[model samples]
Target: MKTERAKEILVQLLRIPSPSGREDRIALYIMDFLHRLDYDVHIESDGEIIDLVVNPEAELFYEVHMDTIEPRAEPFVRGNIVYGTGASDIKGGIAAILLMLEQLRKENKDLNVGIVFVSDEEKGGRGSALFMERYRPKMAIVLEPTDLEVHIAHAGNIEAYFEVDGKEAHGACPESGINAIEQTFEMLQKLKELEPFKVKGKYFDPHIGIQELICENPFYLIPGLCKGRLEARLLPEQEVEDVLDLIDPILDEYTIRHEYTEIWDGYELSEDEEIVQIAKKAMEATGLNEFGGMRSWTDAINFMYNGTKTIVFGPGNLDISHTKNERIDVRDVVKASEFLMYVNEIYGKS
Candidate 1:
């Protein structure tokens, strides 16, 4: 696809506000775009997800999430970069997918492939879970912000929310009363000493920390209650129950009230797998040679859990995703589109 056209599509997609649970608008735009290409599009999950079938019997498919974080930003183009929310997180990848489909339609090639655009990826990943219940492709390429590298492994996570209670005391007094915030910190420090938190893998290291901490003190007295959310990224070899078993004792020691918000296992695809081999070959054909593990949880986990071999890949730096300064280079979109096309070609031959 032409660079100008790709930028236009990306800009249009970025302008729509499809945050988390609200993805109807962007889903409509995508359905219309696919319809114009004369492909059979199917709307699913109360019109929150879309499935476009280029070949019904195709075992290979591409998937991308349509939701961004809340409060979408206005889209703008400056030189080769397009700036906006969701620009890097996923809208850029969506644009690339559209361009690849458009090119395939223009060429009128009957390649064996399908595409799925799902919602709720930024929140619960229920959309992908729903899709897996209905369709099971032999292989899937999940589009995310990977800067064009093929990611065969993805990190899993255990998210917990806890509340600690302490006796209130004056701020000026020392050792008179317990500080709930300090108690929370102590609990976190002890939890960090768990063995799983320090485990390292060939492509990713474990990340364990508190993502959210809250303690309210409107008066001069120390806070009596503290609430925190802890997140732990586990390697493929780590077991969720094993880590939780180690954590249960520490939480018990602090008498912390906690609950698991989310738990999902990490996964890795063998380098000798056909999908991995073809993806690497496609990246090489397009002058890309990077391969790494996805440090973040992606829809690939759902697909893998449902028995589909999946990989994560796309354009844009994940570091800037979900931030106000999120942006993607127009050239990167073009390169990603080219990469997808090559993947299609190589996979078709195999």
Candidate 2:
């Protein structure tokens, strides 16, 4: 596709607001775009996901999530950079996939490939989980903002919530009450010492930290109730249950009530694997030679868990993804499209 046309599509996609459960508008837009290109497109999960079939029998699929977190900025272009919510998070990747399809159609290049535009990725990943229940491709590329690096390993994650209760005392009291907030902090410190946090890998190390903390009764008194949420990124070699087991004693010691809201195990692909080799070749062909692990959980975890060989790759910098300053270089989007097209060529032959 022409560079200007790709930029236009990127801008159009970024203008649409599709957050978590609300992805119908973007899904419809993509359906129409694929339909106009003479491809079989259909909505699944009550229009929460869109499936575009270039070849139904194809064993390879390209996947992108349609939902972003929440819009922090409107779409705009300054020079070659496009700034907007979801611009770097995923819309940029979406544009590259669309451009690749358009260019393939224009060139009349018949290749065995399919596409999935999923929703709820920013929230619970229900869209991808639902898709995996029905289809398992032989190989797949789940796109996210990776700055063109090929990721064979993706970090797993755990989101936990806990509540602690303590006795309240007046502001002038010396040691009459226990501070629940302080107790919460101590609990987290103990949990952070789990073996998973010490485990390191070639591409990524495990991370654990508190994301939210709140205390009840904000008067000039020791808080009686404290609630908090902590998130952790596990290495590929770690298991969610194993980490939890190590923290069970700590939680018990503090008498803290805890619940795990989300849990997903990490996964990795061998360097000699066919999908990895092909992706690396595609990156090299496009002048991108970096190989890194995805520090954030992605739809790739779902596909890989369901027995599909999957990797995460795309344009944009992940660091700025969810911020108001989210943006992407239009040139990077174009380069990603070119890389994907090359993958299609060589993958078809293999």
Alpha-carbon local distance difference test for all models: 0.86, 0.85
Clashing pairs in 2: none
Compared with the true structure, model 2 gives a TM-score of 0.94
The candidate maximizing lDDT is: 1
Name the top TM-score candidate.
Answer: 1
Candidate 1 lDDT by residue in tens digits, 234-312: 8887788888889888887775588898898888889998889988888889999989889898999999999999999
Work out the TM-score per prediction.
0.95, 0.94
- Root mean square deviation (Cα) for candidate 1: 1.6
Candidate 2 local Cα displacement, residue 317, angstroms = 1.8
Evaluated at residue 79, the lDDT of candidate 1 is 84
lDDT of 2 at 181: 81
**Candidate 2 Cα misplacement greater than 4 A, ranges:** 46-54
